[model samples]
Target: MRIAVVGLGAVGARAARQLASTEGVDEVLLRDIDDGRRSEVAASLGAIATPEPQSVTAPPEADAVVLALPAGDHAAAALPLVERGVPVVSTSDSVGDVEALLDLGPLAEAVGTTLVLGAAFSPGLSCLLARHAADLLDDVTEVHVARAGTGGPACAHQHHRALGGSAIDWRNGGWQRRAAGSGRELCWFPDPVGAADCYRAGLPDALLLVNALGPVERVTARLAATRRDRLTARLPMLRRPHPEGVLGAVRAEVRGRVDGRYETVVYGAFDRPGVAAGAVAAVAAVAAVRGDLGVPAGAHGLGASTRARELLGQLAVRGVKSAAFTG
Candidate 1:
């Protein structure tokens, strides 16, 4: 299968690497607006690099496309492929708001293409864990998804934006908007990444999960922060920029009631987060190419559409240790 990975930045580069090396993939094409960086990353991965494109142009008959571009560019980049009945794995939301994310359903079905939206570390894997946890029960009424903040420089800006944006939660049998940071709670992750305060943040998958899981009473997306992140968010004086994407751990926890019993499941990993994030998207892209993912011509997040255990097994084969917890 030929695959095209758009955007060769940190996350994109990682995704490209995985796609190029994964078995059954015949060629990997790299695209970016910057010629220099694009060529460099492509050479390092031994993949073909396209001249800076005028726009996101998927190579003809690519079989599948993996979009590692910014959330803002995802829709435009993927729409061309979707219209052609090609499957897509996007690292982030193409739209800015909850409604925009929800609106992709009709668009995907209309185009007869499959969309694995928000297929990143936290949202991607967290969404998968949510579905798995939900499946363990007859029905799931609530889900709380949390992640450790180890994103790159762009992540700081993203975090600030999430805090300032409206937090969408499931309430009253529907989606409800609340102030960002309004639902702060102390949540425990696996060892070495221990317990920390997780707060509600504006995340697209919260809306996607709501649509996927059905009838959720409450849903929240939170980030696990370090002392540095907290200080940087609040204290202007102490807000010196820290090196990005160097954390040693990444985690996601899903808690809700299943079969009338309260339970929580945690998916934790101890690897450079970029690897896991990219792997999730790359795997979804490959799954789409195989036509075995089981999603039909509509928008779906990686978690909701794919089997959780299968994903965990794939990631495990990559030496990324991820396991579930129950209590």
Candidate 2:
């Protein structure tokens, strides 16, 4: 398969490399608005690079397009490829509306193409674990997810400054705002990675799973701080714009109750913001090329599809190990 990866930033570059290195992928195309960056990545990977999405999406040359673009840029970048009758897989974490997103289903069908979303680590893995737990139980009463990770300087700055990103939660059949660090802390023991403290925060996949699996009595999301001192230093800047200095860690825990019994599952993937973003993009691209996704069209989050576990398993099989704690 000939794969075109949009957005040659940290995540995009990683996705491009993974795609290029994959045995079944005949060629990989790296595209970005920055020509120099595109050239740099292409040179490094020995893959084709372009600055135009159209150029990459043009005709029979490229078989599929994987969007590693920003969460906000998914619709704009993906529509053109859809118009060209090409399949696309994305890890953008911004599948806003299922109905609207899936509206492209017709267009995709018309052109014999497919678009699958929610192929990233959090949405993919978290949702998968939740679903698996849900399956094990006859009646799922609640689901909780906690994600902790080390952010890059840019992300850390954003967290400390209280700028843009706000921790969110999925509860009572809708998304609700939660103050950062509002959720309770629990000791999570993940295999391979060991035990760590996790707190509740907001996550889109938690909501997605709730929507898919129905109302739960309780569901909370949390964020874990990898370095408290580093995060503390930037606390005063939480209200300002500091995308460049944002860095932190994420760990997600899901708890489900069935038949009056409780079962808890914890999952953790450790990396910086760039690598996390890149991992998401890479998985989305690979799934898109292989035609093994079920993403809706319009704007959506990580939970739009129910393929999170399958994606996570693939990540693990590819040597992307996640820590899981059960107590």
Candidate 3:
């Protein structure tokens, strides 16, 4: 099967590479506005990758499409594809983008299309981790998510905006809006990533968990940042972000009652944020093509997908493994 990967940025390029090597995927189409970046990534992926220099105004011929586009472009780019019944996997982490993508649930269902939303590190793997933890419980009451590191320059910029923007959380059966970069807490990720100071950010995990995992007592999301990072978040970026960020990690903590006792389960994944996000997008794209997602038709987060466990396993096989906290 052929899969198209739009926007050959760090995440998009990595997704294309993984798709090129994935079994059953015969071809990987790369689309980006940047001719050099597109051709370079396509060439790096070898013969299986074909560069499409033109912009992606319409859905290209492919069994599945992995959209690693910029934050604000995800919804618009996915509209035509969903309308045409093309399975889409979006690596969108932005609050606005994710919400817009979720709003297309009806359209996707009407067209019999599968649109996997928020196929990124935090919202993507983080959502899956949340589901995994919730599965072990009798009933889940709360979920708290945190992450460290950016995926790419775009991701870094998004982090900046998120820290400075309004943050939202689900509390006591209601949505609570608070200032970004507040609610600071010490979150421990997997080995090496260790402990980092995380704070509330404009993350979409709570929104997705509420919609996907049914009602919960509370849901919150946070991002790791330094004092300078929070302070300068409202201003323009001071330095150029690396094309691909340093090692990143995501953590999901689920709290609930099991057998009349309250318990907490934590799951975490460590890797370059871009790599993890790309792997997730690629795996989701392949699953869409193979009908492994098990969603009849519509937009769904990894947390809500019927094949959450299977996909999580697939991700582990791809080296984006998650481990439960023993402590």
Candidate 4:
């Protein structure tokens, strides 16, 4: 199988590398505006990777394409591909960009192209965890997600902006907008990255969970931040963000009925955000190629369809395991 990865940044480069080594993947087409970066990534992947260095508007033909561009570029890169009936996997974490891509469901369906949205760490794996937890229950009512760590520089900047921006949450059968950095809640993730004070953020997970899970009541997403992080959120970043953090984690708390009784389920996974997101996007692209996911020809969140288990299983093989909270 041939897979195309555009925007060879931190996450995109990792996705391309994984795709190049994946079984049944004969070649990975690498595209980036930067010629040097593209060539470097292609070389790192050896003969299986081909650096296109072409504009995103004219991506090479491949069975599936992974779009790992910046926050605002997902829609533009996905549009032409979807119109051509090409399966797409996006790792965008931006709320607006994700919603814009979700709006392309009709167009993708018309062209018989399956577009997997938010195939990254938080929205991607977080959504998967939500699905897994909800499946253990008879029905689901509430889903609360918390995430810590950043992937690339862009991701860190987005996190900064998210804290300062207004957050959209689903509650009481309607969309509600609230202050982003308000409503503090203590959330505990897996080991090494334990408890943190999480606050609502402009994340795409809430919207995705509501759409993907066929939700009933409330859905909210939050990010872990420090006092300084929250204070500087409204201002421009003073310095470049770290290329990747030491570790990143996502937690999903699902509440609903189990055996007609009230039950709460929590599941989480931890890794470097960039690495995990890359793996998620790569696995999703491979699944799209292998038809293992059985996703429909339309835009969808990673866990929106019935392939959550399959996708999660594939991710586990790559060392991105999900842990359940026993306490």
Candidate 5:
């Protein structure tokens, strides 16, 4: 199958490279508005590169398009391809506008194509963890989620400046926002990465879990930086917004109370922001090409459904792994 990767930024570049190396992909097309970046990746991967999504999708030979663009641009990027009968797998986390995303589902179906959104690391793996936890329990009473990461230089720079330091939580059927520093500090032990500090942050998957598992009385998400300097720099930016470097860890913890017992599962990795994003994009792209993805079209978060496990398991075989931690 032929695959096209949209958005040649950090994550997009990584994803494009990974997809190019995957099995069963006859060709990989890298597209981005940035000419230099596109050319560089194209040369490195020995794949086709273009500046327009239309160019990649126009022929219909490209069976799937993986979107690694900014969260807000997902709908804009996806709608056009879905309308043209191109299946898509995306890493965008724009669940706040469900109605807008759902509006595109039919268009994809009309074209006999599939659209899978929210296929990123956190929502994708995090949601899978929650589902696994739910399956092990007789009843789920409360759920809490926390995540933190140092993104690429741009993302890291933004965090250091305290820009976008807001975290979202879902509980009792509503979404709540909190400052990055508002949650309590908890030390989580993730295998391979070791123990790290995490706090509550706003996460889209928490909301999806609440919808699937029932009303959660308390759900919190958090942020943490591997480098002290980065964390210190981000402290001030909590009061402001800025985008900068990206380098750090992506950590998430989910706690569920079942049958009067509390169980916690943690998922984390120390990786380049672009690398993780690229891995997610690759998985989504492969799933789409193989026609094995279980997600429906529309703008859905990774945790919106239980179908993500199949995708996550595929990713794990490629080097991504999650584990449970105690005290």
Candidate 6:
């Protein structure tokens, strides 16, 4: 099966490389506005190159299309394909332009196209792993997600825009708004990455969880980073990429009563968040092509429609570290 990957940036490039190298992939269309970079990536990956990605069409022949562009650009790249009845997988979130992305639901449904938003790391695999935690409970009561990663420009930008803003959470059976980066909690991660104090933040994944397994107690999304990095977020002009060789991590703590007691279900993953995001997006796109996900028509959160345990299995097989915890 073939998948058209739009953007061809760091994340897009990684996704394309993974897809191209996959055994069953018939082709990987490397698309970008920069013709040179698009062709360069295509040649490097030994795949097709398309400088004009907005013109991509799906179905009746082609497989699926993935959008690795900035959150702001997702709709532009996806609408064209969705309007033509093409299934789309996006890495953007409900942070910026929540309404705009939400509006795509009807559009996709109208044309019978299935749209999966936040298909990247945080909103992507994080969402998947979060649901895995919920599965450990009979009735999910609370979900707290902690994500720590230094992503690409777009992802970093997402972090920048989200900090110090009003964060959304599901509490008391409805959406409540609070100060972003407000509440703080000590969170433990995988070895070498260790633990850090993370703060409440406005993240799309929380909204997704609320929609997926909610009407419950509370849902929170937190982002963790070193003090230096947190300080750096204050200066967008000097935003630096993730240091030389530091991997990223996503951790989720799902709370509920299992059988008759209260407990916490946990999950953790460590990888380069940017590239990991691409891999998640790639897997979702491929599943779309293979009809493996069975996602419904219309825009939906990754956690709401995706089979979390099944997806975690997919991620692990694709070289991503994903697991569940008993303690």
Q: Between 4 and 5, whose lDDT is larger?
A: 4
TM-score, predicted candidate 2 vs. hidden true structure: 0.71
lDDT of 3 by residue, 4-83 (tens): 99888889988998898899999998899988898899778889988875854557789999999988999999998898
Better of 3 and 6 by TM-score: 3
Which scores greater on TM-score, model 2 or model 5?
5
TM-score per candidate: 0.87, 0.71, 0.98, 0.97, 0.76, 0.90
RMSD for each of the candidates: 3.1, 5.1, 1.1, 1.2, 4.6, 2.8
Per-residue lDDT tens digits of candidate 4, residues 1-327? Answer: 889998888899889978987989999988888889888998898999988745545656999999999899899888888888889999998988988998899999898878998899999999888988887888889999999999988789889999999898999899999998999999999998999999988998877788677756999999999988888889998788998766989999999998789999999999999999999999989888777765688888876768788789889989899999999
State the displacement of the C-alpha of residue 239, model 3, in Å, after optimal TM-score superposition. 0.6
Ten contiguous residues minimizing lDDT sum, candidate 4:
51-60
List runs of model 1 lying over 4 Å from the truth. 47-61, 93-102, 226-244, 248-262
Task: List per-prediction Cα lDDT, in the order shown.
Answer: 0.69, 0.56, 0.90, 0.88, 0.59, 0.75
**Regions of model 4 farther than 4 Å from truth:** 55-57
Residue 155's lDDT within candidate 1 is: 48
The residue-by-residue lDDT of candidate 5 on 1-327, one tens digit each, is: 778887776667777878877888778877776677777878888744433443444433478888766555677767777777788776654444333555687787667777765555555555555666655566665555544554344334433433235666765667677775555566553544444566544345554566555555655544554445335644454332223223444454555665788866555554444566578768777876666665555444455445556766766776666555544
How much is the lDDT of residue 8 in candidate 1? 71
- Cα misplacement distance, residue 212 of candidate 6 (Å): 1.2
| TM-score of candidate 4 to 2 decimals | 0.97
lDDT of 2 by residue, 113-225 (tens): 66655444455455555655565666666766654442333333323432123455555556666555444465453433345565433334554566555566666655454
Q: lDDT tens string, model 6, 1-327? A: 778887777788888887887778887766677778787887787534433443544422347888887767777767778888888888775476444666889988888878888888787888888777776678888888888875676677677667646778888788888876677789888766779888767677666678787556888888885565455555663746542224878888888998899988888888888778888888888877676665678887667754777877877888898766655
Q: Model 3: residues >4 Å from true position, as ranges?
A: none
